[model samples]
Target: MNGLDLGVVGNGTIAGLVNSVGNYQWLCLPRFDGEPVFNKLLGGGGQFDIWMDGLVSRSQSYDTNTAILRTRLEAEDGAVMEIIDFAPRFETRGRVFRPASIVRRFHVVSGTPRIRITLTPETDWGDRKLPAVRGVNHIRFNDGELAFRVTTDAPVSYVLSGTSFLLEQDVSFILGADESLTDTVDVITLDWEERTRQYWTKWARSLAVPYEWQEAAIRAAITLKLCVFEETGGIVAALTTSIPEHEGSERNWDYRFCWIRDAYFTVTALNRLSAMGTLEHYMRWVRNIVAQSKGGHIQPVYGIGLESDLTEEYATHLPGFRHTGPVRRGNQAAEHIQHDVYGQVVLGVSQSFFDSRLISRPGIAEFRQLEPVGERAFAVHDTPDAGIWEFRTIAEVHTSSAIMCWAACDRLSKIAAHLGLPDRATYWSERAAIIHKTILEKAWNPKVGAFTASFGGDTLDASVLLMAEIGFVPASDERYVATVDAIDSTLREGNHVYRYKTEDDFGRPKTAFTACTFWHIDALYRVGRVEESREMFESVLSSRNHVGLLSEDFDPSTGDLWGNFPQTYCMVGIINSAALLSKPWSEVI
Candidate 1:
């Protein structure tokens, strides 16, 4: 219930979602898929210099359909200013926020008030060497032996550039209110700020949002889009990776690459906002995946922006967030075969066509490949696979995996009918029915009256909540009701929703899954628990950082966001849940 304890309790754990006051706590320079250049939110400042502070009242919000955050700063000395930060989005995507870069501009609105500025950089998350006195107002970091200039508008008063600067640690340069050090830095000219303001204001007008809450959604969408590299149209799951699950827990991972499962949600969310440019870019990425083998089968994830190599690496130089070990960069799970991803991909593309007035010609052309793709998924519909949970343990016959296959087939059938294709609609329909029956019989335990986490496992799973979401079971079905009850009683601990607590064959206990929690709200709404659904949704939203962004998990006690920051699936849950909640019963769930 209390606001997130980002500063003290979860110190250095990337508090970008929680902080305000014109301070940037986390950022990975140049590109989202690149190693972090500035990551103060993960604890003890990252690789870039930051210098913006004032005794000012600050509030943040998006400007309409754009992902730009406008921060209004009211100084204690009566000086007022506004700062706009946005990453520009390309129109090749639709119905989503797509600002390209995080541009910050400051302007005086009232009396002149001095602001404190600081610039800091974590060179390679502690792997790069820092050369002192490199620049009068800057420092050069050796990230991959590449020089990064850390420049700012602040004075260099003894900075805490880390004791391990020789070991590639983070560095900072503080800027004071006094004008004495102004000449030492490259102060952003007023013309540049004016130009940025005009550009953003004009771009905001181009977005098509229907309500006041649209601003926040816009920001969320844009931030998600920014995580996608434009060159490859690959959407990375998050900005930073390998922030451990809990104190000393070794569940750290590298999420700075693309996930096939996320493509569907990303496309659907963007299409809804009419962000055609973003949608097209990702669709291109998907097409490339399909082209790999001329089939729809997909790996669980891939390297971002055409980076074929996704080998995982341990960052031995930088201490992990709060000293959690095993900081990593690339995702070794790139070749993973999660069966449920096929459904997610189909659903993402299908929803774009079904729900929105916004359509892209190129996007549509790419989506038409589903017929061949669906056949490939059908080829292995019943085979055991890495399930949606991505367990490090042994693979299993997860009920959700089968249900997702059914979904893929079911949607493929409809899309075929819509497009007037001579597809095997009857075959898909029959196969889908069989898949549903198999799940109900093999996955269900009558005594528990709920779906098990996997075939032969006694433990119930939060994935049971998705039985209604994918239409595998009617929301009003008696078994569906019991499944929700089972999940709420067992899996729901306070506000956290663990995937399953029992250690698998690999001896690793899965952490709480945030997307599953959001899926619970959808299940609740589908079964006509509208009021209860609203309450749950609000409670989940409260778990978000101050900026309304969620990570992979939230600590029930301290409200610290555990796992990666600005997670893609969590954001997908936000968009989908919002859609379901906003619809009338007769229209949608």
Candidate 2:
């Protein structure tokens, strides 16, 4: 019965997903793409759990305006325990001290609560068990190149043997590097917790969130921030990988790497909140990728460290999420000719040229480098590729890809104008106009009375909603409005929105693409259906997990979240919808 009802904690360097019951179910050590030390979320054998005797009820939530999570467990005998989980993140010395670590503090609320600690870590995607070497105050887990230590004040014997013990005093567990602690566990953990709490609260206070749904906006912003790899500025699509889009669909794919499209939306959402740090870092990452590409073809996805060859493979050793097989380790989309990526890269990096708050601004050199990307986008605007959906067998000149290509040219023109290069601006603007005209004629199917997924196709695609969103089409235009209505009547199922109705590589999409639903909501608001948009937005907001987190997909009938845990796409949707649907601060305050 394990589900996506999970809470995430990270320090920007590494992240861990804790299930509702206070188990460290999914954690990648050292870095986001490092080995999975706790893989039970994918039905593997590694986990860290706190079991209370005679448990009756349990609930989980984040500490206000922080990445810290609190799971409250109450026993039938009136014993209560609260476990505080976070990866320590705060400024230390002259730099930020965000290490690859997780801290768990156990506080007994009532009576003498008896609890048992289970800490088991595996390696090689749960294919091998790590050997533990116990010290007086710590246990070092070693698995070849992978090694970390757990320092605890609780008895090592009790933890190792899983023996039930009375929790009369507050305890602490620090899972981090192999180095020993310098101070007492209680002293250092308390200090780290307070400092981390202050750090997050201070960071949250800086966000310019919407008047309404402020809490959802802040939580989504924080979760999106957690997905960032501070070391390289690359943002992961999600923390854990291989979770099926729908159970038994075998649509599982690894989302550990950074996708240009996902990162574009992620930065755009965070940018709305005035959380510019992530954008700054991500722009740096994008710059690195662009520089390495040397104006050549750019992959849709890459490792956080900018490793490009993300060859997809199945980890036959471990069973998939919910016992579905084929736990994929890498994404094959890295090899896909996802032309939309050209636009995504330009769009994601465009903020650097416009935003003056950034430490490093893009100048003529950067503009010169980006011109080649714009050239490629214009060249491939009408070509066939995998599309945004990344269909395996079919190749179509997807409308989404074409529009994004248009976006690349449009943004490049604006950037060129900003740089005072009128000739270059005119060149890019003219190319954008050509792409725009082509899409208007080819992508719009008069038979369906809407813009289809691809040229000359009669099928409806949720991504077409982005036409109005990206300003390729006006919201008030009859064609865009009719497209929205057509999709509303076809692909939308109540509050949920499917990406498309047609079967492709998979038989058919069985669950709602969480982000597409948000796009639909945004489109409704833009089309002046304010009340309906707000109602639908609320419905999707209610679908979030207990800790206000969302996955990539959702089961409309069962209300179960599926796909990757803590999906960046879904988190971005929450922020974008809240920003669009929320009332203005002048009206509210």
lDDT of 2 by residue, 324-428 (tens): 877998899999899999999998988889999988888998898888899899999999999999888899999999999999999999998999999999999
What's the lDDT for residue 304 in model 1? Answer: 70
Minimal lDDT window, size 10, model 2: 1-10
Candidate 1 on 388-455: residue-level lDDT in tens?
Answer: 76765568887777778788888877765555554555666776777777777788888777888777
Clashing pairs for model 2 are none
Q: Give residue 399's error in model 2 in angstroms.
A: 0.7
Among these predictions, the greatest TM-score belongs to: 2
C-alpha local distance difference test of each model: 0.61, 0.92
Model 2: lDDT equals: 0.92
Q: Mark the regions of model 2 whose C-alpha exceeds 4 Å error after superposition.
A: none
